[model samples]
Target: MIERILEQSKALIHVLSADRRTRHLVLTWQDTEVLESIHKTLHPLQEFTDALSGEEYVSISYLKPVLHLLKTKTLAEDPVDTDLTKSIKSRVIGYLQDKYNDPITQELLDIASFLDPRFKTNYIGKENIPAVKARMKAKMEEGTRKEKRSRVRDTEFNSLT
Candidate 1:
């Protein structure tokens, strides 16, 4: 919302500035710089949002990798970043970190990433790899045991019939 407003408003501000009567309404050069900074800071997130929201691909497995990229690369502080841009990036990264900070939620996302053939443990930490594998193995075994029990029940029923 803010991003779109910044884009449209910048263009409108330019048009308005061309008129002597409305020139005062135009943003000062510094404020315009701030708006550009905001656009730069948020542009990557828009790309990520659009990509993740697409219908052709599954998105759940992308959560960890995308979050990691946002924190470490896309939103990472750069020497050129204005203070406001830094604050915006930090706030966004912090909020997402808080959401996924819960141990259970983190584990679930890790497991989803692990299960995805394309990702398969790539986003998981080395220390956590064994644990993730153990969890996966346990679920697989549980499913196999249930199937075996079901088959036995079916076999016994057939014999009786």
Candidate 2:
């Protein structure tokens, strides 16, 4: 039954990609389902990687399990086949975009691209995020300074009067 599903999936994926005029797009329903399952199974790994890396809110360790899981599933032609790193990366980016409201960073995007074509052109660049962070930090500091100054002024006024 599983084998049947995998075969159909490969055919369907090939058909769909071909239909879309994508000559090499390949992923059948079984492969798609398996990839989804792999994604689901790797949630814990991502959490672990995020916690370990101090980038808990923005980590991609969840991908490892998916890749590993793909090893077990059979491909259309091969007994088992896994997507290239680029495909994995794009999926990760897509996952993050769908799951989180945060803007995708260039560093992460680059890492994804480096990892797989799935990440190709997914983000703009790293040069912009830092300026935004810096500006936000500066605004916060400025607000704090103003609050402290107001409190000091109040204290001075009370002491003098």
Candidate 3:
């Protein structure tokens, strides 16, 4: 579970571009503080940037204790802070207020409702199977069409090279 969470976090972080000047990921100052709290769990990981005159790049290494600390941060466990959790939950809900009328979001919510363990899966299994399969098949066909188009485009593009 820890490894899964770690991989998820790592994948997200891998996409974070480093600021050449600050050597820090371009997170907001507030997020930087949150990250620092999280970062302190492990051996100190230092970030460098171009601004650090003689430093070629920032190097941050993940050590074992930090990995262990993050392992315990799994979502399956109740969040340690009730106020923080409720506050964050409400903030996220507020963002969805405008999107409540969207059909796509509705459909996603329907799928999520089924996946949520609180609900029985019977309705999803019997009533939604066709719709789910239709969506899946449509997505599969679209992917195939995209691959074919890309192959043809690549051939055309390469012939001109």
Cα lDDT listed for each candidate:
0.89, 0.50, 0.45
List the candidates' TM-scores in order: 0.85, 0.31, 0.30
Worst 10 residues of 1 by lDDT: 1-10
After superposing all C-alphas onto the true structure, candidate 3 shows an RMSD in angstroms of 17.6
The lDDT ranking, best first, is 1, 2, 3
Residue-level lDDT of model 3, residues 128-160, one tens digit each, is 656865776788899999999999999999999
Tens digits of lDDT, candidate 1, 1-161: 65665668868787998999988887777877787888888889998999789898789899999998999999999998989999999999999988999999989989999999989988998998999999999999999999999999999999999
Over 4 Å off, model 2: 1-80, 83-93, 101-125
Prediction 3 global C-alpha lDDT: 0.45
Report residue 56 deviation for candidate 2 (angstroms): 12
Ranking by TM-score: 1, 2, 3
lDDT of 1: 0.89
Error of 1 at 71 (Å): 1.3
